[model samples]
Target: MFDTPQSTRSGATAPPPASHPTLPADRPGPHSKRLGYIAVIATFGGLLFGYDTGVINGALEPMRDDLGLTATMEGFVVSVLIFGAAIGALIGGRMADSQGRRRNILMLATIFMVGTLGCVLAPTWETLGVFRFILGLAVGGASATVPVYLAEMAPVERRGSIVTRNEVMIVSGQFAAFVINAIIFNIWGEHDSVWRYMLLVALAPAIGLFVGMLRMPESPRWLSSQGRDDEALEVLRQVRSPERAEAELAEVHALALEEKESQTGGWSDLATPWIRRLIIVGIGIGVFSQLSGINVIMYYGTQLLENAGFSSNGAILANTANGLFSVLGVTVGILMMNKFNRRAMIITGYTLTTTFHLLVGIFALAMPDNSLKPYVIMGLVIGFVFSMQALIGPLTWLLLSEIFPLKIRSFAMGVSVFTLWIANSIVAFGFPPTVSALGISSTFFVFAALGVLAIIFMWRMAPETRGRTLEQFEDDFRIQHS
Candidate 1:
């Protein structure tokens, strides 16, 4: 929905103001370097979020065996966290908006720690699901809040790269979890406590995030919006070049004034035509992103492969391949984000994914059920996952970060991403039944049909937001559908 004036200037090309005497004349010094480290440390919340959500891919079978779980209990164990995450996403936004980003994250870190503990020490399926749900609350909130915090703290030029770096970290965290899970599962395949080890590994990163985020500053934009200019400036100086800091502060102050005057925070903002349209676009992105069935692959790929005919070991190994491809695809997507138009990338991604879905369905139907079927189906499934990670995955998070106004960034993102988790839960819970009834080919064909619809929706409604500042993007969003 953006209508901002396009500029080809690189991030480094923006000129400093003449009057801001405190601004750096050349480049940042050692202090700025340290600030970058702090940002990474603070964003480790994302890493923990990624690991906790993805670890189940390897651990599920062991968990099922240990708990004597049926299909419904297994689904509950996996998808329960998603249900909690949906709630967290809804409430975490308000917390971030009112309590401040730093505080909310710290609280999330505590939740993360507690959730991990609950999972590790769980005596039964019932206990494990409860803890996982708590874990999901923290993960969901962190997902909604971390990107906004990163975006606000980053320099305008580096904003996309910095915020997207968290996405990279997220995928990397998932990769790390998969690798760790493989190693642990391989070494302790016969051990009764194997799943416990897999689940407990998440605690290290949670501890790291909790401790690291405590020393980080609150978001400067959030502070400025609250009329705490001095604190905001102090935060800005810590993260930005001295010369650039003042100008950025002025810009933030101007925007905060506008926000305050308009009283455009919270659900009421959605009443305005432009705001309503923006929220719709945000929710659309969330729904389409999930409807791509990425979570179906992430949360249930191993089961899907087993159904295709692989032994348990083979399925676990093949699932690892899926994780690796996901990491690789996200790497490619991040590299291309700066080079490609957002809308074009999304359209191309949906098209490719839909085509793969159809091909996989056809292959599943035509090939007689045999040992070769698992490997063949594995190849197609991994291919679809790669397409999603390379295209839709990064784009979905990127667009969510790009669209909303500064005033409602956290709240709006929470609402949209909360819906994302709900969608994920629906797929997770329904996938087994869907597969049993419709068969794999038919199930994927349904996804393929949805993919085509997503493509059409993107072409008509999604906006190109690449290479624009947050302030400029906001202006563009206000009038995009007018």
Candidate 2:
């Protein structure tokens, strides 16, 4: 394996790659500002993922009332997109690996437009569900692709912070969805097509992503894999400063050659012990992230609040609080991410969330069934959201982006994220029924048990990957498995 000279900054030794050229401290210039814009554009996919998944929380009830949906249909509508997302994640991963990350994301942007259009125009619940599933395909693909794209292109110093920005955008998108849902519902409270309007707002960002990505560069790492080093260098120069970009491009090219000579790029590559172990770790992180039941809160917070005793409008308004807190939590987490170790964050987050779940379950069970009980439980639920957003939420995506080798980064993350969506689908599809049959208290207790398992699994399997470069971490992971 080729190794680049290391530089120690703030107690962490950075691997070969320097800070991205554009943002180098030696000279602050226009390139730095432009790179920041590019990061925002790339993260638009994350925004759409957040908004599309979260809109269902407030829109589902109106949609149910409008289309006369039953419990099964309700679950179907909510989870159908997750099914499409699963397939999209798998196919998008392969496509991102084979095609280019930028191209695949642009294609996803178009799919987002189509899926949003379908949902907006559908006259029946069946049609809306189908459209939602289609939308999910795009969302899943974007979720898998965007983070990898960001991770691959980001400089070593900023990788965690940059990749987690996608998480921030995701929660921001969810917050936007909640706010939009509330505003639209409040204005057109009795309108027949209010739900349709809720679904349509996603188109604006979908269009923005499609247009913005047109001017963006492809992943330089992907280009290097295809033996297009010159193009890769040029693209790197666009994002990095000239000196650092040249140095980083050389390092990337060297690694590409090493990986090419080994020819370990696919299913067969995974057979190697080190590669296999990394893949297992990658998948474990993805599964544990979903097993936290965060999506259950995002997709069904309104309904969960309603079950806790809030009225319809009250539920919608209260759910907006969930979205806002989620965004806030993610912001706080991202700020702390660069400052702390990844393993510490994950362990701390899971511990707090598990404690919240147990407390919430106990509070719900013990509190009297008065109006105050609902508000108190809702407060606990909000606390749970805060805990999740602040810790596990961003850390999960950050770790997935960090753990894999470059040769199979897209494929590995795709498979891992695909598993995440599948896990998400299971929680989403089963949550309503679980609540109905087992009641909210028992349902959360089950998640609490899962959370405890996640904590143990993480402690045993997850590495401290916060400040390491992808290349350096790859060597460490290889040694660990060996």
Candidate 3:
């Protein structure tokens, strides 16, 4: 079995406590304000992630008018970014592990800016696809890196809420995109090329991430992993209460020392039984989160609205409600993360979302083609979005950040999120055509079926990751699988 701290052993047989990461009593105190600052800056990675992906939802129609896009081309445009993200998640995870999280994020920020500029200026649909892929790399990198940075910087107890701050930003970014797209489309609906303006908004956050990260501290856990214990503790003191910093450092130092002897973080480590199980869990979380058919809505909500009978302008405006409620969902989600059990929350979310998907299908199938159909589905879609953002969405990222040991955390996360992107790619590429050929009712039924599989997999395979240190959780996995 892998090594574990003494205090965590009592948790082995019982389902993990509360599903929230709270520090031991003595370790809680007056943390530095820098913790809040760091969360804001680093999570811009998420904001950009949201804005870039969500922008395309409203832009696709105008781009089709200008570029003469076939349905296949539209699917390709959306899925290419996701495919690039799969590659990025893989590469970025390795980079975060080897290059240091702060350094990796700075590099990603630069890529985000360059990629955004490239997409904005692309002369053709083909050119736009290439730049979108580049931007995907940055999004994937940020997804794998930022949460790790936040989790490592935070006090043990605060890890749940702090790490999840990125999820809130991601949805908020999407919300901003929807709002911006609506406003711009309303003001400039006559222009075929106005999609460029919609995409341009992403540049602001990409720049913010680059500038803010320059002044931020490197992750203390990452420093210690590199045999820089003194530097790790120094970084820790910036965000933590002095006494808590010292205490956390001792724990971090012990874990780092042990990791150096035992781990060589790479794909080969998958041979280890516990690590393999953990990787499977991570990948499942990523895959199922998307299988909830959430991104399909994020990517195609305006189209779906149009399909249901709204005009171009009306659909774009209606889609903003989805964005607004997602932001609201994440707000409530962050607050609830402090108290809930992770497994229970996810399971409940899955049940409700699956039911909602089924309802959308039924409503689309049974409700006569009329004005009321669109609003009813929109209301249900809003509920589905809320359950996803509030219940399963943030925790997906939080559990990923919390469950893995420090050495392999990013690598495992990269692999998992890679699958997430790939799954999303399938949905993106498949959704438009599916909806076109089969109509909305059958398309949603397919998603509902997929949701059932995700619920089963999560119920049986996913772990509860609350109320523990990184070292403690790793040890439990090791022991459980041993």
Candidate 4:
């Protein structure tokens, strides 16, 4: 068989394609700055996504008290939104294809507003759950659309870093949630509805995203696919230097033409062995990311810490550290994206995370159930978050965005992310019961086991996309399986 495309080659790979033009380090270019502006605007969706999901971490206990939630009901409260998110991801992909990335984000922002409003106004547990599910539609849509939007808008050479910015924003949003939750809780001190204030804080970012995205350009790749070549070129020129814009537009347009010529049907095209293989890889990556059980810390950190023996106030305060370290980790991960191999970094993350998982379990099993135990376990949890955010979290989204053929990219992302949310929903819903039955030590052991399987999956199926053009990856997929 022909040598695998140099871009995806394991070692001694060729450099990035020429279409990914670079400016001198001494001086920043207008084009890069413009691209940065667009990225910042689009990633507000990620901020909203993060805040909406994470606000519940600290808010849940108060909500439980307000709504009189039982353990099963609490699980339902958390997991139901994730289930809604799965549907949102499914629909968001198709919407991105039909509605345009810009429009879909605008719509998601509106959904965010509506969801937040509903939650804030929710007077009963049933209504609160309904609104959380509504909020999840926006969260899931943003999750499905934002990365794909960034990937499509980005320069081929800068794709990894640019797309991963959304990941950073996601973590940043979570950090913001934790900080706000702490502030509100500390100030209000067991007020019956403190969670409402926390939920309401999300409205600011939702409004910002809606307003900011109005001025953002449509994805050039999406435009090309729609036969709007002139519009596509204009969007490219706004984000790229004149020469590079022309060149990249040519590449995108040619791929668009090829897609049109193929006459392949959507969804059914996935049945082909090669496309099926890609979906499997995509789904595997998506599922594995969640199975890492990082959300245990993200969603129910307070409960976990309380279980480990911290008081309620102590748990929320300590959870802020988790949020802080998460931002630091994702920031480091973003900086490292251009500097390391994707597969190696992700595998290392998995290895480290799995080790931490086992260590946490081992400590839980061995430690006395005393004051010292929570601190030690918290340290382990912090390390796990650091490792996860730095590697698998960002890399998983980046891979999912780039892995599929462009023709079905959004749809495939939806499907992949839908599977991811499904996994997330299962974990979120099951965690309380699992922890109740399995105990914290046993719970982490299960996660560690999943991490081991994740390593195997990455080794066997994950492709290296760094330094490769999306077009090149597309070509590689076709050449290898055709």
Most lDDT-accurate candidate: 4
Per-residue lDDT over 106-204 for candidate 3, one digit per residue giving the tens place of the 0 to 100 score: 999999999999998999989989999999999888888898889888765677889989999999999998888878987998987799999988899
Can you write out model 2's per-residue Cα lDDT over 144-232, one digit (the tens) per residue? 99988988877777777788899999999999988998899989969877999998999999999999999999989999989999999
Measured against the true structure, the TM-scores of the candidates, in listed sequence, are: 0.91, 0.93, 0.93, 0.94
Q: Which ten residues in a row are the worst by lDDT in model 2? A: 1-10
Give the Cα lDDT of each candidate. 0.82, 0.84, 0.84, 0.87
What lDDT tens digits, residue by residue, belong to model 4 across residues 279-379?
99999999999999988888988889989989978998889999999999999998888777787888899999999999999999998787789999999
Candidate 1 lDDT tens digits, 37-74:
86687668878877988899888888988889897898
Number of clashing pairs per prediction, in order = 3, 4, 3, 0
- Cα lDDT of candidate 3 equals 0.84
Compared to the true structure, candidate 1 yields what TM-score? 0.91
Query: Model 1, 17: alpha-carbon shift in Å?
Result: 19
lDDT winner between 3 and 4, please give it: 4
Ranking by lDDT: 4, 3, 2, 1
- Give the better candidate number (1 or 2) by TM-score: 2
Residue 155 of model 2, lDDT score: 71
- By TM-score, the better pick of 2 and 4 is 4
Clashes of 1: 3
List residue ranges in candidate 4 displaced over 4 A: 1-28
